[model samples]
Target: MKQAQIICPVCEIKISTLELPQGKNAHCPRCDTQLYRGSHKPLRDNLFLALTGLLFLIPCLFFPFVTIRLFNINFSANLVSGSYALMKESSVILGFIVLFCSVLTPLIVFGTVITAHWGLTRQHFTIFKYSLLIFQRLKHWMMLDVFLLGIAIAFFKLSEYATITPKMGLACIFLTQIVTIFLLSRLSVSRYWQRWQSSEQFQFDDVQTHCHHCHLSQPESQSCVRCGFIIHKRKPNSIQKTWAFLITAAILILPANLLYISIFYSNGKRYEDTIFSGVISFVKSGMPEIAFIIFVASIAVPIAKIIGLIYILIGIQFKHVTDYTRRMKIYLFVKWIGKWSILDLYVIAITIALVDRDQILDFLPGPAAIAFAGVVILTMLAAESLDPRLIWDDSASNTPQKESLHEK
Candidate 1:
């Protein structure tokens, strides 16, 4: 039996599906797309990395990531201990943020990967689906970038008190990031979906039997193959989530811009700058490139991303599918650029790491830095969790000629 043509999600082009023989790969007929071709990571390589990560996970959480040595009196704190100190001091918000970014996210990512591998070996699909969601969520909270910021700030602040340095736990934390990315890249999503499709127990009529929108024929539901519509899962939550996050971010941005993000000291004099003040300082210093980067990263890009996401989401929410192609373009742009908004976090980190001059100059990150980082990361994840196909659902109603005209 010939494998029927199916819509390609990325390209939105109908292509013939080629079924491979057992233990082989398939390709798309129209695009010549290699459906299951990914660089084969050796089994030994994966096992070695996973094992190394497991070994490091132990020390990464326990040993001190930062060591402060002041006048021969040394203090050490790791992920959990730091969080505890923050909690004891009643800095609950920072404590929770640090705990989630440094400890919980890594643990979840590593644990889910291990679980997924073990489940795959046992051929358990239920475990696979649960583990997949766990891994996806981890992508948001796994703030290697944010932790780096904290480390930089800690180093700068401790200059007067001590010579701060990273320790074994810090090294292990860094390694975990590499390990997580490596492991995830090894498992291709398209390939996994293809395998699920080929599995004998995975019958189409079993789960995806009915049309999602019309509850009619599986293929001929509310969706027209010629135009994509939600034959299932009508309200995709993209608009709702985008609007919610954008509004939340907008509110936070005000406080983040107004409150002091960091305090620097020079010759016993204090210098404090809010988010906006820092951007202005960069511009006044005759560093347009730096100024532009800080401006775009700290302010423009984030707001733009949020606003753009809202536009796309609203367009979908109201079933205003006329701009299907344009909406898709905007969606793609938002997806790609939102992550770079983390550049503000990078600035905070770099400043923390470098600015210290024996009380002549010192740097300390503030509440606003944390809040801004949260906004950037939260919005980014919200963007990721949103399904882009939701935008195309309404496209199914339009004829090909109409779609072509709209595209033009």
Candidate 2:
């Protein structure tokens, strides 16, 4: 008996009739809509990315991303030094921000990424489960973009006072992050799970619908106008978690500001540089550029990150969006802004390197910097951890689809 074939309503492509698997995908050859379905994605690519990312993570941690040279005096700064300097400067809020992004978050993220990849590659079920959990938890904490921005800001600021030199460690970190990104791009758990199910034809009874460009949804018959892609009714916890983290960050911001951030000791006088003071100091110093950087990194970025997270979360929380395009724009903006908090660390690093040795002009860090750094890193992690599809959930129903014209 010849199998029945269904024609795609929009693309008019002929699809051979087969047992349509739940959570699987089939595409229209012409327009690439979900005409029939199979699995999420292939596991091999995701596994490869996780493994490669892990391998590169080690050097990313151990190496110093930047170096400073001043008046024939040279010193190396690491995560510890950066944090400590902020504490000495009495801007411990800023100090903490530096510490988390540069040190703690990176360490946790690298470890988690590696474990997740290794578990999948070896097919160690127990390890894979644990890795999935770890990936979920630490995914948001890794802040590569922030680290890079810190490096850039530090380079520019330090150059004005001392000759800033990029170190081998910095080079290694840059390369490793590039490799890690490539790896992350390849790894997707949903795809792997789907592939496994396909091989076994497992009857999981999970009715999952996905759209490559549009967010995943319940089998709908419309293409999204924003991305011109089909939509999904459901999406990953990316949006919810993003919103939760953003709220948490917003709540913490009050304490971060209220508490001591960092203390700056210069010329036998001690002054605390709060979020506001940091901005004032730079503006007063006639370094408008540096002041602006500080304002964005320490002030503007954190708040923006929170707001963006909230927008994404809310949209996803109540799927079927009208602002799909706008939400996407906000997510990208949040992603870019999250790194600005690294400014505090670079400034502190420069302060430590420049003002420490001179007997008449000594500088020290404080406590608040540490906490602030934590806020920045954690918030960034929250952003990275979120999935991007929540923005499209609102408009899934009426959105145009390639398959709506013909029904099975």
Candidate 3:
């Protein structure tokens, strides 16, 4: 049996699915977007990883994740401490964001993965189908990888003044991230959907229409039969929606940089630092690597993303086909790097958790913390809203007469 043909969501190229060798990938011929990967590990392995990750989650949530020693005073913090600290400082919204990203999101991902795998293996088709749907929606919100990077940056910043040590819970969180990633790689939703169709002997007419969200073939349907997402040839008002988000993010970037990101008080002295000043502090402190990471994630990437989106939007508006491929690559790069912009926000959360103490020393979330977070989130939305397909549309229409004649 052959796989169904579908259109690439990113590039809008019609592609005929092929039987790929194990561990191989199918790429869109026109835009070079990866369409799908062949199955590698069995379902059972993914199940084991999911279950193991769940086991790791308990320790990560309960025990202290890191210990910091400053001025002969010791402070220990767990996964939940970051949220609590933020709330204690009256930043309730930021606290909730941290709690969702660090705790609730990971828990849901592991639970959904387990449910999907177990239900499928036990032939509980309904449970498997629903579980897979929820999993797909929730996966994008999982930010354990970004949270870990934030922890690294916080450690570098704090190590200059305090002695910091990783605890068992921190180790568990690290291990859980690895296991979750492995499970996700093996649990291919498309493969499972195909298997379910075969098992139920379900059949639909051969059609070229594809679900924008699930990227699955469907026959003249309003919603995807597999994932229930609305079927659309292209995202509605993609360019306009992207421009709105970009403009909002561009405006926020000014406040996000100019206002204070964090305030530190030690021995009756207060010090405030903005995003740029924070990066400069790291440089003056002689930790160039950490400074570079902060600079790129906080300062450079956001500016670059705004410019890239503007360039792509302009190219689309003018029907310019020159360097279309490079523009597509830029779109991909912007999307991939947007998540890392949250690194500084997470660093502040972790620092507050570990550094809060009376009179001797304490750190507080400053005005820019909220503004900076807004910039990160808005830019991410903009990247998601911008349709990469628009980058190739002009080139696709302007194909030389020789190529059109050959095809005909």
Among the numbered candidates, top TM-score falls to 3
Segments of candidate 3 deviating more than 4 angstroms: 1-4, 118-127, 198-206, 225-228, 397-408
Winning model by lDDT: 3
Every model's Cα RMSD, please?
7.1, 9.0, 3.9
Q: 42-99, model 3: which lDDT tens digit per residue?
A: 7667678878998998788889888998888788888889988998885998898888
- The TM-scores, one per candidate, come to 0.68, 0.60, 0.89
On TM-score, the stronger of 2 and 3 is 3
Candidate 3, poorest ten consecutive residues by summed lDDT: 399-408
Whole-model Cα lDDT of every candidate shown, in order:
0.59, 0.57, 0.79
Clashing pairs in 3: none
Write model 2 residue lDDT over 93-153, tens digit each, in one string: 6656556655666566556556655665676655655555565555554566556666665
Ten-residue segment with the worst summed lDDT in candidate 1?
399-408
